[model samples]
Target: MFVRTVYATGDPAELGTAIRALNSEGRDLLEERPGYRGAGVFVDRNLGKLLTVSWWESEQARHNSDEVMRERRTALLAPFAGTLAVENYEVAVFHVLPRPTAHGGLHLIRLEFEPADADQLADAFHATVVPRLEALPGLARAALFLDRERGHGLAGTLFTDHHSLAASRAAQAAARQAGAAKVQMAVVGLEEFEVVHADAHAG
Candidate 1:
């Protein structure tokens, strides 16, 4: 699977309005596109940042939506956005813990690491990271996406709520470090986000 993410920063109030507009205008349109799978919006009200991600079956499908997405973004977010960035990645692993109970309000973590030794990284994720994540308190789901040839990786993790996420910070930090080292990779970026709008079909 392939993924595209739009990162934006703006006023909380304007962001709320912009997001609603996106839902009605562009979000729904994605589902009608070829190879569309799912999408989700992640925001941080206090930080005034939002990250929207959409899933596609292939790079071509993702690229096909670029023009329309660009137009929509320019029309809707131009006034509200302070900064904007877009990125694409290949999904290496997508795992949802069975029977997740805790619900409502999600604490999301996005970690990017170097992708050296792709095979080793993938192996370590399944053997080490997966189990640790599944055992984490209040974890809902986690996915690791990588560009094997480019030496880039994106790890997205969702927690049940703020407290649950904060409580696991220590352990998560340790695991992140160990995992990166195991694959001879360096941590490039790590950020926290709030899941603002999620739907049944969202990835």
Candidate 2:
């Protein structure tokens, strides 16, 4: 699957209403697009920024729907422009596995790393971490991306809940013990966020 995430910083006063409108627009578009899978909107407690993420069956599908998405997003945020700072991202990797929970919700985790460690981290994640986590229960997906223009390397995972996140971490630790640590290095000076939200596209 392909993942696209957009981050918007909104005035505290207008945040709630803005997020609702944006989420509604996204939901409507996703519902009409065949390749649309799922999505969620998360508000950061500390920064008060909102992150909107969606999954698509392919990059083309996402691109094909861009015009409509742009129009909807513009209309949704017209009233909140002065209160919001918007940015969109094209996800480079999206790996989908299975969620352990039968309840069908999604837990999302995003990590942003320094540019210097991008290559090594990406390699380590794909070669070691990804394979191990992919085997764990509730690990619905994993994706890695390099945003050189923005000096960021992004990695994300989708799970059913805290248990799945814990399991995935444990699996990664085990992989490190098994000699995957050489290529991997702890990511410092990074920003991370964890969010739990309902699957807006759930059938």
Candidate 3:
């Protein structure tokens, strides 16, 4: 599967209203598009940053839906406008345990690395990172998205609640450090978010 990410920073005061619009009107519009798989909406309220990820069955499907997506994006973000950026990625790994729930916590990490090391990175992720995360309490899902040509990647781990997320922080950091060193990937960005909405389907 492929995914398109829309990210922006907006007015913190309008965060709730923006999320509501995304969960309702935005989602409805996306569902009408062909090849729509699923989507996740995340927000860092304090920073007024929001990220929306929508999955598609193929790159073509994602491309075809771009215009409409931009239209939706404009309308939804108008109230809380800030800098906007978009990226496309291929889903490299997706692991789910008990499934995700609304208001769950998300640990998000962004990385930069050598494009040529993609295979080695994937191997290390599966052989090391996945196992370590699986052992964490309250963990629900883990996903990795890659833009091989740009040497960019994003990883996310979902926790069932705030307590679980707080409890696993130290362990998560250690695991992330070890996994990144194993593949020589530089950790560029790391942040926490609340899962505003999540709806996924099994293949």
Candidate 4:
């Protein structure tokens, strides 16, 4: 599987409007394309940041939609977005305890390292990090996305609610450090968001 992620900065108050646009118009646009699986939108009100992720069955399908996405993004997201960055990744690991829901808490850990270390990082994520995360309360899903060429990756965990998300922070921090050391990757950043919407049509 493959994924495209969009990171944007905008007014916190306008996030709701953006989410609606994404879930309706954006979703409809992507669904019309071949190999489209599903997508979600998350927001960090404190930072006025939003992350949108869409899944595809193959890299070719993902690349094919880039031009259309640029146009749709201009219409749906440009007004609110002060800054926007788009990235593509290979899905290294994906495990769902349950389907995600609105108001779910999302935590993302970003990593950076040499492209040569990509496989090692993926292995460590699957063998070590995922198990620890699965044991946490209210874990709805976890996924790791890696861009080998860019030597960038991010792991995201969605919890059922705020309390469960908060409760797992300490454990997640420890796991993050340990996993990074095991894979010799740098833990570049960590961020949190509220899942405004989520859906998965393909496993």
Please report, in order, the local distance difference test score of every candidate based on alpha carbons.
0.73, 0.57, 0.86, 0.87
Taking the tens digit of each residue's C-alpha lDDT, what string does model 1 give over 1-203? 88888888988778778778677776777877888887777777787888888888889998998767777776766566899988888877777755332332344445444545777777887777878877887787777777766777777777777777778778778777768667677666677776655432335
Candidate closer to the true structure by TM-score (higher is better), 1 or 2: 1
Residue 154, model 4, lDDT:
88
How do the residues 1-203 of candidate 2 rate in per-residue lDDT, one tens digit apiece?
A: 55566666656566667667765765776779778877766555456566667766776877776667766775675554454333344455556654433333333434455567666666677776677767777776666655545645445666666566665665645754442354434333323344535352322
In model 2, where is the ten-residue run with the lowest total lDDT? 100-109
Residue 107 shift from truth in candidate 4, angstroms: 0.3
| Tens-digit lDDT track of model 4 for 38-61 | 888999987789999999999999
Q: Between candidates 1 and 3, which one is better according to lDDT?
A: 3
Instruction: Name the candidate that leads on lDDT.
Output: 4
Return the candidate ranking by TM-score, descending: 3, 4, 1, 2
Q: What is the model-wide C-alpha lDDT for candidate 2? A: 0.57
Clash pairs (backbone) in predicted model 2: 97-140, 100-138
Q: How close is candidate 3 to the true structure, as a TM-score?
A: 0.96
lDDT, ranked from best to worst? 4, 3, 1, 2
Off by over 4 Å in 1: 98-116, 199-203
Q: Count the backbone clashes (under 3 Å) in each candidate.
A: 0, 2, 0, 0
lDDT of 2 at 158: 62
- Candidate 1 has a TM-score of 0.86
